[model samples]
Target chain A: MSTPVLELARVTVEFPTDRGRLRPVDGVSFSVEAGKTLAVVGESGCGKSVTALAIMGLLPQGGEVGGGIRLAGEELLALTPDQRRARRGGEMAMVFQEPMTSLNPAFTAGEQVAEALRLHQGLSPDAAFAKAIEMFRRVRIPEPERRARSYPHQLSGGMRQRVMIAMALACRPRLLIADEPTTALDVTVQAQILALIDEMKRETGTAVVLITHDLGVVRDHADEVVVMYAGRIAERAKAADLFANPQHPYTIGLLGAVPRLEGGAARLASIEGTVPDLMNPPPGCRFAPRCPFAIAQCAEQPPLAEVTPGHQAACWRAPLDTLLEQAA
Target chain B: MSAPLLELRDVAKGFPVRDALGRRRGAVRAVDGVSLIVPKGSVLAIVGESGCGKSTLGRLALRLIEADQGQILFEGEDLRGLSARALRARRRDMQLIFQDPFASLDPRMTVEQAVAEPLRLHGIVPRAQEAQRVAELLSRVGLRPELARRWPHEFSGGQRQRIAIARALASEPKLIIGDEPVSALDVSVQAQVVNLLQDLIRELGLTFVLISHDLGVVRHIADRVAVMYLGRIVEEGPTAQVFGAPRHPYTRALLAAVPGQGHAHAPLLEGDIPSPINPPSGCRFRTRCPYAQPLCAEQVPPMEGTSHLAACHFQQNLPPALVGQDAETGGERLRRLQAYFTDQTQKQGELA
Candidate 1:
């Protein structure tokens, strides 16, 4: 089997606060195999975005790495700032949530894309322009040549996203990290964008780390699913198995909460309580406060245990297959 | 029922477009030849993509923007018959909830002031009783009455929307038009707001005309659904019929693209929504319609229906999707969505 493209082993991101070194991500581990996809899904401030930002080495100021962040066999944590800068857009690239702000206003769509190629590959200006235009074609940007000179404002919301994808793919990174990429896009455009990424991954065999709160999007795009709550992995499994049988209460709650388009009478089962304050995380399973199936043992931090091969859930009732079946 | 509290008869709106040569070019038809019957105390959702005349039709219904052609009837009275002052007086019964809560709310005004402003302006209640009325409205929409004292900046996106809703409810209107109300909110938050709106519809017995880009929200809130394409309603039917078993190809495509719509796709359209200024001949959706035939391009498809309506000529020819029958399979359908998306992904690769 091919080596994993990106791996986070016991990765935790910490910050120095007035109280103490508050850990935002605590001992979380996940990997993205080549040509595969892993989704980190949870509500806001659940450490989904933080985990992605940590992987990208784009953590906001005052953040410190407390564990291993490896990309293509290299220890990213050990790399200097300049070296990491070299790593970004060369081996690993990030596609952000908001394309409007991520893209520059002054630059034409082509110029912005070509800038990536030129900066990374040191291609001649003409060569870079040609390559950027080709990338645009690959992403299915209409009238690639004509759209090349157009500014971000000139293109529609979906078209702007295509441009962002073009820029991300321009470098042909080994690992692509998309943080809520389609959250802002309309449904049709989201389908197209997801398809674009899926196509790119198949063609290039690039490993992708998708971070989003949307369960359906994760189901649609991911090969593996990582359910994150309160800066910890609640459950991790293949997308099919995860959806077929969600183990964690948080995962179950999330699945049950989503309103289906078919219009059922089933009441959305909201997981009780908001995500705990990251400033002072709970001692036990962070989801214990919200978990209906939580036990006294869960008051002590539950270890991420393998309930099944290729599937792990950090729950005392991890093997509640029968209960899950009943709930579904 | 209730004589269709609000109605639009042959309503259309167009704005003058100027060319580079500084001459007045052809008018941009924003909403064209649209008609709707918004029954009292029920929710009617207008679902469509951008430039689909949904918003314009929504505005035309309330006369927020005047229709260049056709009639707007409020409780069997023609809106145009009334003088400006009389129209303003009638407007107390119809209020609009805009798409963006951030932009809709007055920045300078406190939530209390914003909500009570309507009460004061319309003199719905005694001037001294405005504060109590505002608080009651706030709490009704699931907001804390004390929140009224704070500014919009102090609240989250959902909270701001609640304040907006509170303000909309201030007039005690019979019919409320929510233009993409929950499209801007988070899923969990959206569900809360959607539920709140549903509760409002039931409790207040206020008629709702919802214009939204999110069909899921429509599926939940609307009694009847209207699907628009290029300034025209391509399909309109009972929410169940339109969503469970969508007839039109365009409607099917829209459903297929919806996140949990049981049917997923490789996005049937290759290009953007066409310029309404130069809409395609025949079926407006023909340019991007996946199942468009030569006949579709030759002659315009009339918006036809027996009891419910659709404008697609090949409605019967298209493959069946759950339009009205979807409610029974809601959970099962979402569970199966992963398979559908994977299938589309495969098709995309194969097509590519």
Candidate 2:
């Protein structure tokens, strides 16, 4: 079998606080092949963003990372800071949630994208600027030549995101990590930006790690999904199988929580209680406290095990059908 | 039907735009000549993207911001004509819930104090019974009474929003306007809040005006929906009718833009929402409307239809909304999986 474009093996990220350590991302493992999209789904503080940051070697100050992050069989943690920086824009690129914040307000949109090209590909100043305009055109920004001169604040939210995408893909990196790329924009503009990313992925065969809290976006865009709860992987499977036969209790509760546009029950199914604080996580399964099907055996953490052929869940009573049948 | 609990007739509001040097450039017409009626004990959701005036309309309805033009009638009385003192008295009947719970709440105040402030202001309860009243209010929104002593900063996002809701309900309001109340919450917590709001609306027979951009939430909670673009409402109708058979091209495009509604490749709208400072000549949506014709630019289209209305010249001849197959979400198995969730909740209820 061909090697995957990117693979994470039991990644852990911790930050030392005055009150002991806080592990935001704990033992997360997943992979994405060339041209496939892997969606990391979670709520606020679930460490989905931290995982992305860890992979990019962009963790905030005081953060300590452990475990393997491989890009095309190249071990990333073993690389020096300068070597990592060299490979960042050339081999892997990340697009942030808010373009207004991520982009430099002082630079014109065109210059911002062109700077990446010159730094990564060693293109001439004039050639890089010309290619930046071409990249803008490829992303379907209208009147690319004129619009390129506009600063970040001068462009609309959708247009600013287009510029960000153009910059991220200008290097044609093997891996693209977009952290909630469209959450700040309106839904209509979100559609346009998502389509642009999908199109670019197909054209470049870039492996995508899309981190979002919106299930609808995942349902439509993701090839595979990793459902995270309290910094731990709760479930992982092909998107179709995950949606159809969600094994973990958290995944089921999350799927039932989203208000379906197609219309369903009047009242949404809610999982009781808030997400557990990760500062002092539970001794056993991270989701046990909130899991309705939790048993005494759940006091010992369950390893991520196969529930079906390619589907894995970290619940003691996974293959919940058997659990339910036993209960009945 | 009886008279509407709240009504707006040709309401319009504009904010003056200023350049960096502070010179008056032009006014951004936020809400332009919008008219609607909210019947007693019903949910009317105004859905649109940012800059679409849904939030501005909600503020106008509550008199939080004054409209430059038009009449706002509350229970057959015009609010625009009310005196300052009279408006304060009327304020007890209406309340506003903002989108961000963290920003909306006061960190310094305890939950009990925040919830009881409205009661004290409105003279709903005597000073002696204020604590008891606050406790009851907290429990009504599904918060524990003991948590009342805790500060707002101590609560989670969802908990803070419940405290906000409890405060909103303290004065026993008849009409509530929630501007993207659940938008900032996580999916699971959002569901909990949505269900809580649903129960509150039903049990209290409250009239609700939900201003949100989330179509799925609107479809679940609203009896009727209004789709806005630029500064004007482009479509208004029963939620089922509008979602099932949208007439306006803009509304169709908005529905199609939902993530799971159609294939990702088939994008509907093109350019961003045009600047509200100098909107299009006639129809505000014409710039992005796929089926826009010369007539659309020539004259503004008046809203047509009795119960269901669409403000478009070609609304009648527009093609049906092409939302993709319902089976893409893995329909049958998903339903079966969700059924187990419902069963588990019921079992929990029984055990309790």
Candidate 3:
């Protein structure tokens, strides 16, 4: 089998707080094969964003990262700050959630994208400018030349996001990490952006690490899925398998919580309690406090075990019906 | 049929756009000639993207913002005809829950005080019973009474929303309007709030107006839905009908645009929604609409249908693919997903 384009093994990110070190992302491991999308799904503080930032070496101050991040079999953690800077936008790129904030207010969209091209690819001024326009047109921006000259404020949210994507993909990196790419856009615009990303990935065969909280998007867009809870992987599987046969109580609760478009008038089964505080996370399963199928053995950490072929879950009573029947 | 609990007739509101020099630069029609009826004890969701006027319409219903034109009738009484005092008194029967609980709630005030202020203002309960009423309202929204003494900032997002809902329910309102109430919350927390709102509406027999951009949440809680575009409701109907077989091209596009619908590849409308200041002369959606024709540009299409109204000329002639009745049911997918949980549990039981 061909090696994965991007691989993360036992990645852990800890931030020092007043009380102690708060481990936001604890021992997460996943891989994105070339041309395939791997989505890390979770709610706020689940360490999905932190993991993305850690991979990019953009963790905030006081953050300590441990474990391995390999880009095309190259150890990313071994690279110095200068080397990491060179790798960003050349070998890998990231698209942030908020386009308005991510973009520079003073510079025109064209200038910004051109700057990325020139910095990463060492293209001449005119060549970089022309390439920026081409990237804009490729992203389906109407009136590419005119839009390129327009500042970020002059463009709409969707247009700005297109510019961001154009900038991220200017150098044609082997890997693309989009963190909530469409969260700020409208539904119609979101569809367009998602399609654009997918099209880009297909054309370039870039391995994509899509980080989002929306399960619906993950179901449609991702080839593989990793469900995160309280800085830990709750479940990981192929998209179809995970959606078709979610095993973890947290995963089940998440699926049950989302209101299906066709499911008529059924009360959603909400997962009780908030996410565990990462600074003082639970010892066993991070989700044990809220897991309906939690047992005494859950007090001790449960290793992520295969529930079905290619589907893994970290829960003591996964395939919860057997536990229920025994209890009955 | 009995009179609608709330009715909006050709309601229109426009705010003047001013230049840097304070000169008027045309008007931006936030809500333009929108008409709808909310039956008693029904959950009516106004779904749309930002700048679609759903929030504006909700504010108009409560007279929080005055409508420049048209009639707003609540309980068969025109809100415009009511005197200031009468309006103030009537406000006790109608309440609003905002999207940002922290912003809506006063930081200095405790949850108890925030909830009790409504009761005290409406005189719904005597001064002595105000505390008890606040406790009841808090419990109704699934909040602990003990937490009422805590300030809004001390609470979590979901808890803050519960406090907001408690405040909304304090006056024993007959009608409640929530403007993107759960949009800011986490999925798990959002579900809890959605369930709480559904239960509250059913148990209290309150008329609900939910303004949201989320179609998933709308499908869960709403009985009827109005799909707003630009500043008008292009389609309005029962939730099932609107979702299952969207007639208007825009509605179809909106539904198809939903993630996991398998229609992501199919391009919907193109370009951003046109600016409201200079909306398209005829159909506001015509500029971006793929089915737009010369007639669509020349004349506005009148809304058609008895219960499910759609403001589009080509709605009747739309292709089957646009109207998604033949598409795979999301319920089937959900069932398949749910079966995984059940199947796993069963397999585990056998092992045990």
Task: For each candidate, report its DockQ versus the true two-chain complex.
Answer: 0.23, 0.59, 0.48
Fnat, 2 decimals, each candidate: 0.18, 0.57, 0.53
Worst 10 residues of 3 chain B by lDDT: B343-352
* Model 3 chain A poorest 10 in a row by lDDT: A319-328
Candidate 1 C-alpha error for residue B204, in Å: 2.1
Write down the worst ten-residue block by lDDT for model 2 chain B: B324-333
lDDT of 1 by residue, A1-328 (tens): 7678998999999989898887878889998999999999887767888888888889999999878989988999999999999988878888998899999999999999999899999999999999999999999998999999999988988899889888988899999999988888767778878888988999998899988888777777789999888888999999878877667777766775566677764345444334677887777888876566667888799899999999999987768655446666
Q: What does candidate 2's lDDT look like per residue over B52-130, in tens digits?
A: 9999999999888999999999998999999999999999999999999999988889898899999999899999999
Best by the DockQ measure: 2
Grade the docking of candidate 3.
acceptable
Docking quality category of candidate 2 according to DockQ thresholds: medium
TM-score of each: 0.88, 0.97, 0.95
User: Arrange candidates by TM-score, highest first: which order?
Assistant: 2, 3, 1
Model 1 accuracy (lDDT, Cα): 0.81
Compare candidates 1 and 3 on lDDT and give the better one: 3
Residue A70 lDDT, candidate 3, scale 0-100: 96
lDDT of 2 by residue, A121-189 (tens): 999989999999999999999999988899999999899999999999999999999999999999889
